[model samples]
Target: MLDRRNMLKTLGAGAAGGLTLAGAAEAEAALTAQASEALGPYARPWSPPNDKDPHAQNIVALSDDYFVPGRFAGKTVIVTGCARGMGRMAAIRLAREGANVVGVDWLADEGRAVIDGIRRDGGKAVFVPGDVSENAVCDRMVATAVDQYGGLDAALNNAGVMDAIYPGDPIDYDKQKSLIMARIDQASDDYWDVVMRVNATGVFRCLRAELRQMMKQNRGGAIVNVASVAGLRGFGGTPSYVASKHAVNGLTKNAAIDYAPYGIRVNSVCMANTATPMVERAMQILRERARATGEGGGIGMIKTKSLLQYSDQHARDSTPAEQVAVMLFLLSPESSNLTGANYATDGGFTTY
Candidate 1:
């Protein structure tokens, strides 16, 4: 008798045996249905926590109205930074949309929880715990997607770092301020190197791996890099972060130009301040600064002011789902005509 693991292995092997697109779709449906049957009634719908913090909202699930059911069926996708925030949401949505997902992150426990949650919801996914800064890890990510799901169809390069290499204690105001709001002259060698390694070089490495795999498969694929508004325009403080994001946008354009002949589409999402854990941590630091110095002008305030000036929406950060909506569109067939485009997911923040 075939166990669940062996059964999935057999299905994956069959998929890799050169099935046509239509045949692959049928196989994919059968795989999902059989996987669900293997789990029986124990499978349950997974939902994000109902947290009071806006940044923590929309962590696990996207709204039913937002996703096109089975849009990513038979496709294999890779998502980075899958432990939390936008990356987490992207992974969940991709699996929910019927994509076999390979989730990569350095946060092992949290990342595994995400993959486990997807499985619990009757979705196919696996977690690879490693930092994208390493080239070997990037290659392994693509390998996992292919080995587990037959082939790679898409990827969301969403892993990134801002401010500091490591988080400081809440009472360490001086350290936090320096890390979060340092000028170019004030930035340290360690600070610049860490940011570039993870943000700029990391995306480059991921793109290289994903593009190579798609090229080898001789089939078209889609990729969405999570850039930032800083990539489009300038921002005070966080020079390393801004420069790294600009590098991401540049890489997106270059890759799209070179790989279009291979039928691969590469694009990026330049987002403003979103309600993510990264932004929330920065906000906490700025709020502390405000209380200590009684000053109002900080990163959060500046972003809020800019958002209010250009958009009709409320003066607040965007939710993770809002950004993921744009990402999913770029990854799906709906945005086939778009390549090398650095789409601003900001609420009109970069217009002026």
Candidate 2:
């Protein structure tokens, strides 16, 4: 019955006993390694992958200078949408900083690959494959964290959909044009419902489950929702996405206020056009439309008018690492007093 608490006590006792300092240090290292190995292969360290490795390419490796080494040691974090993009980056970085991560996503294989990369980097992580829009999946995510790593300490609700989920048929240009370039009047019920379900209600479900777990533990935790710059203001031709993001901000504030007394903090990172798979898909759509319409200036002109909102400071899209930096700060104790804030990681796009 050697639990974590008892194991720690034993280590302390060994340090104070007749054993030399170096001997005690070696003993502790061996015990820690054993404990990690007992968890699973993913908790054990492996050789780093080569540059040409597919999983290695998927990983967004941050410089050692960016890490605070063990800043989140012994913490357990749940990151939704951990398959790729911002969510993947956050999970890897947090694990590198010594947090035990439970990575969740509907993209099962991709999610597992990300978790594998984390483990290979000498970090602990597990993957949960399911959509965040489901209540059961949300509950299961929190439960996995508690069961695996003792309890939940923080979360990043980053799963979301920017566009409507189309059917299995070939591309419907008419529907695509309407969905991407339509106003509220032209947006279909399916378009609005699908986006809202995944982007707005999805976050709400995750937050409810996470907050409940934190409350039961009564030690408090942090939550960072991945909202967007559109949440701060109206963005033309994306009625569903805009409205859904605004809802995310609303949920963040409400939870922040209600949970502050319990020592829990809730905030959001409202990012602008970040360089993600989602954004790349969007650019591809715009490029197709531009070619069809005989438009000039290619991707650059389309991005400025649509994504960057003509802001000079946003001449380039942000990297997932840049957005994850803000997210990690909010989740860390460094932003102890920051809650209920919709932080604009928007490259000053929201300024104007």
Q: Highest TM-score among the candidates is held by which one? A: 1
List all candidate RMSDs to the true structure: 8.7, 10.1
Best by lDDT: 1
Candidate 2 residue 215 C-alpha distance from true site, Å:
0.4
Off by over 4 Å in 2: 1-65, 166-181, 290-314
Worst 10 residues of 2 by lDDT: 38-47
Candidate 2 RMSD to the correct structure: 10.1
- The residue pairs found clashing in candidate 1 are none
Clashes of 2: 0
Model 1 TM-score on a 0 to 1 scale: 0.77
Tens digits of lDDT, candidate 2, 114-143: 999887766789999998999999999999
**Number of clashing residue pairs in every model?**
0, 0
